[model samples]
Target: MNNRKYIMLDGKVIDKSITETEFVKADKNYLYDSFGKRYLDLRSGLWNTSLGYSDEIYFSVSKEFSRLMNKKLAYLDIHSFDCKLYDELSTNIISFVRNNMKKCIFTNSGSENTELALKIASAIYGKKLNVLAINNSYHGSFFGGMSVSGIDIDVNGRMGKAYEKVKFIDFPDDIISEESMLTWLEINLEQYDLFFIEPVLASAGVRIVSDNFVNEVLRLCKEKNTLTVFDEVATGFYRTGKPLFADRLKYKPDIICLSKGINNGISPFGSVCVSEGVLVRLEGKPIYHYSTQNGNLLSVSSANSVIKYYLKNGSLLEEKVGKIETQVKKVMKLYPNIVYRCVGAMLAIEVEKQDIMRLNTILKDLGILTYFYNQPTNGLTILPQFNINLDVLEKALRIILNKIS
Candidate 1:
């Protein structure tokens, strides 16, 4: 037997001898393994597949792009020249965000977008750079992302001393009053070149920060003339029942890092949507960054379809999520031991740390897959597809509640 495992799971190489179940097919919201057993993927492809597997919009878009590629009509390299798909994608993304996003820079993934945003920030600041981020927040895996990330920055001392300028402050908490938060920012925001934040800290057990706190952060950044970047990679594209979680904010972010649902997980694609101010500052900056797959035509086409799908069905989907939230709250009242939070289609139910693994395994055996974590909070996170069937979700919830009860 070959001892070499060619794949890494969760940043560690897995033992090759340990066979894993393979998902051979997918339905609306369920994945089918080779044994023909089906499991509901409540995490929605790591919260990227908002429309779910086998969605008609996704299928149609994919088919169209495949045909175009076969005809050799849509091959485009971002480094070369812009194409019609690029123009349309930019227009739709700008309108979808419906904020101060004046320009869009395409990238390969969320990590790449984070790195590019930091590069742009570095260009604006030129040499001396200080970044302030909230504790328990995750940006991505890139060096710049890891630096700004409040969590996992010092994992095994891997980040090194290259990002000493990046600092972290406590996320807004009950113990830390609003006054204290403002005072700290008022005195220190000026020294920082950029402030990175996630409206909802997905990796931190789906913790949603208060709107007032986010707005205050923006106000202080504005007052101090510091750039604010909203890391919306996980919370963007109608995740919080809004176009972007930033939509709920009082002030617009200078730069918005977007990915995940941008293309409905159809491709490795992401984008940095910049405000007019940030765009102006980026002009003439010798920030040389390029990727052959940055503006792939197929990704652009899929993104266009995703934007259209949201525009057409966003209201109905949001209504469904609202009903689901209400239903879950009612059930949660019965279980005092469980602490849970729901924002739109996203949900987090915290349980005892000791029970984390047991519950996750039980759920998996019962044919329900969710995102689970034991850090910051021990809980199971459920992010159902926006177009998920309510009755199906109700059944799944019942099973989960019964098992926990």
Candidate 2:
């Protein structure tokens, strides 16, 4: 066997011989490898393709790109050019998030959007760089994003020294009291300039924080002048049974970082939705961040199409997600040893530590793609498209249950 010529860096040393060939085609909620094996994409292409593999988003974006081919517009310098596409896209994005946020800044990835939010907070509160993040939560993989992330990833090497500025707090587990949490924040709140959160900790075993906890945290942050930034990169765009998980909270964040499902996974794009108060602070500030693909025409158009799609069919999507959640809960009841949690289309199933690898391999062999969490407890995360076929999901679930049992 000639050693595989490609040098792919996935941070894992898997047996290349057992790996399947490259995927040749992707239809709705499924992928076909070169050998013609069909696999249900339960992870929704890293939880970004809320509308599944093939949708009208592809057609709309292609049509727009064909009309405006090769139009390059950078975020910092686009003001000089008459970029009507940029303006139209920005307006559409603002409309989607404007109920809780006032302005939007585009980026190419979730990490960049998160990093930009941190920079904006720093710019607003100079000299107060302390940030509060929850343990076991994940924001992204970039420097700023990793700094805020509480996962045990190997980020403390030479490049990870920047994470020293971030202080992590324990996530409110079941036994922790609200009063205790409030007291802890009251004592330590003034020292931090920003508090980053994932409304539903999707990467952290799909843990959903209580509304009371979220409301109290926002209240304390307000009292101490600490800016709140919701990293909704994983939970936005109907992933959590709402347009944004923050919609369920009583308090609105100063900044909300969104990505993943914005363009239904058609493009790599992210955005930071800022409140009017934060925008005022950034109004006259000189540019501190720039990316070549920031507000790119194709990405913007795709994102616009996704938002419009959601606006039109949001109610139906939400209803379908509710049905899926009910099905998941019922299946979970069949196995007492198995523990699970779900929010809209996202689900996390926990099994014994020893069986983690075996279960993952079995699920993969059964033609289901899933994600695993980096936690002490073995957790498999599933985030299917909002409108995933219930029949397909039910079949996959039965297969998973049978293997685990």
Candidate 3:
């Protein structure tokens, strides 16, 4: 057994030393542990590896980094950067998300992106910082993010007290009438300066809100002059069969937060894309947030490659996600007792709490990886890579069904 003890894996139950022994290399859609056991990565490495491991993007990024090795610099002011490569990469990102969103602010992770968005909104509406977030939505794990997140399991004791200015509303449910949801929004519209939401509640077991509900919320926000922020960390970059889930919404949000699949899981990167109106609000003000690794050359290059790849191959990737959604629906039909919700390549199945643990163990034993969500109810969340082989996915589903059914 490995004797090293200064390591930790979040949400892991095994002893630290044992978990360390499982460390190994990853290639494509599989992970090989020290014992040479290959496991199918269904969670896509925390739902970030949309393009899978060891992809060409990684190789290209390596080459680019090598070329720029001597010139690599950190903590430089964004306003004074003169690197041509950096400019090209930034331009590519802005063009990739062309439309009302003309400006991009880079961050190192989804949590930071959320925090930045909040800060921008706060700056625009100083002293009027009342924020509204949906229940069951997860923004991130950082203090500011945890304050707005509905699922407090991760930050319960550690977060101290929730932000007093932030309020939570129940996420729209199928059981709730549209009239009721609209009424609630109308009542609370004038109280908040900003509204935050995840296009798809991925961490909350892939819960999807109806478009009507979202549109109405946006309309109310517009009327109240409250800025709306979409946490697209989990639903952006064609993960939802669209470039961004916000694209499907009739009413556009003022600010959009993106990460996770932004760089096809190749680098730790996140960005907040804002509309011209929102940008103008902060044009003369100093941005209150800054990180040492924000918009690093490596991350920028990887993001450029990932965005270029997606723009070129989006149609094929959409078809692949469509097939996976179809497969999930078919599986759901076979087991009426198991409730399921799916969108694009993401799926969530609800089961008994005990069954969640049992199925997770079985899936692990079968060399498949998945995430279990215990909040809002027990659920097995599945986020497979966009290009996952159908045969392998089918086999994994079969194994799950055989064991769960």
What's the TM-score of every candidate structure?
0.94, 0.92, 0.91
The worst-scoring run of ten residues by lDDT in candidate 2 lies at: 71-80
Candidate 2 RMSD to the real structure: 2.7
What are the lDDT figures for the candidates, one per model? 0.81, 0.78, 0.78
Please give the distance, in angstroms, between residue 73's alpha carbon in candidate 3 and its true position after superposition.
6.2
Off by over 4 Å in 3: 1-23, 70-80, 153-158, 353-355
| Model 3 whole-model lDDT (C-alpha atoms) | 0.78
lDDT of 3 by residue, 217-319 (tens): 8889889898999888888877788777876777889988888888866778888889999988887776678776785777877787787777778788778
Candidate 3, backbone clash total: 0
lDDT of 1 by residue, 191-287 (tens): 8889888888888788866788888888888889999999888888777877888878888899999999988888888989999998788788879
Selected candidate, larger TM-score, 1 vs 2: 1
Ranking by TM-score: 1, 2, 3
Which of candidates 1 and 2 is the stronger one according to lDDT? 1
Q: Which candidate leads the pack in TM-score?
A: 1
